[model samples]
Target: MTPPQVVVVMGVSGTGKTTVGRLLADELAVAYAEADSFHPPANIAKMSAGTPLDDADREPWLDAIAAWARERVEHAGAATSSPYGVRGVRGVVSCSALKRAYRDRLRGAGPGVFFLHLDGPPELITERLGGRQGHFMPRTLLDSQYADLQPLQADEAGVVLSVAEDPESIVRKAVTALERAAGADNGSGQATG
Candidate 1:
């Protein structure tokens, strides 16, 4: 059987990472994690005050999320499942992993970790942020997030889904893409493993 998959729902702020990630987790029948929960109190306070976190401030937070991912994968290691019906011990996380280095840190968590990048126009995201309430990440830092965003590269196990579609459709697309990626990786001569 294929190993369990850890899907990282990644995007800049206001791209519906949490909403879509929760629905995706439900669809896949996997445990869900919110990356914001891993943020240190100081980081949260800084963001709440409209301060963007430097890489120095984010390393620990990213490492915490990586540790959580590794723990979940380890706990699910012995679980078995067939190719049909219920899948492997899947897990989903929503994170604003806006740079390649950050994504590399997440990839280090374990095997079968893939990314689902929710991407859309800046205007659309800005509009969504304006309407959102009670989030530490404010609209003021949107530009920095965009500047930091580095799309999944050729070697990455991931797919980019447009936010123009509804959440259900996006999740569906993600599942299909993940299945294809797993298949490709399992086939002969596939470089991804």
Candidate 2:
């Protein structure tokens, strides 16, 4: 059987993951979720205080998002238990899945957990972060994020897109690439675009 699809829009902060993810979800008519919403109050407070969360701090947050992803998969045509509460077999989510281990953990959500990695130069991301407002994550944490990021390996089922492109262009390219991957897989469950 062909597995249900879940596209993970992943990158460090200020990489436009949320904007592009929402656009992609809307264009594809799939449910959308923000990884930040899965974070606990303590995690928010820690980041608000300019403190970078250690692995333990992010464990619960990642688990919550993974749970949501799995819920979307297992429910298939049934009503989703997520905030959208819609009946859909597909989903798009924005998450800073910097490390390989974290992405692997998220993959447990389903067989079709494909990732869309957004990346750009440090200076570009830093400027974007500086201009961004109302976010708990501090720009100072960007260095740590880059340090921890492990780009997708050749064997991983995913694609890397540049953040330097405009949002509309990026969304268009992402949709095209992911669709091509979906059609090319032939029920093999390999969706690397």
The best candidate by lDDT is: 1
Q: For candidate 1, lDDT tens digit of each residue in 1-193?
A: 1333788899999999999999888887678999999998999999989999999998998898888888778887544332333355468899999999998998789876778889999999999999999888989999999999997887677788999888988987776676666666453211221
Q: In lDDT terms, how accurate is model 2?
A: 0.80
Give the residue spans of candidate 1 off by over 4 A.
1-4, 77-86, 186-193
Residue 136, candidate 1: how far off, in angstroms?
1.1
Model 2 / residue 179 / CA error / Å: 1.3
Best by TM-score: 1
Q: Supply the global lDDT for candidate 1.
A: 0.81
Lowest summed lDDT across 10 adjacent residues in model 2 is found at 79-88
Question: After best superposition, candidate 2 residue 169: deviation in angstroms?
Answer: 0.7
Candidate 2 regions with alpha-carbon error over 4 angstroms: 1-4, 78-89, 186-193
lDDT of each: 0.81, 0.80
Ten-residue stretch with the least lDDT total in model 1: 184-193
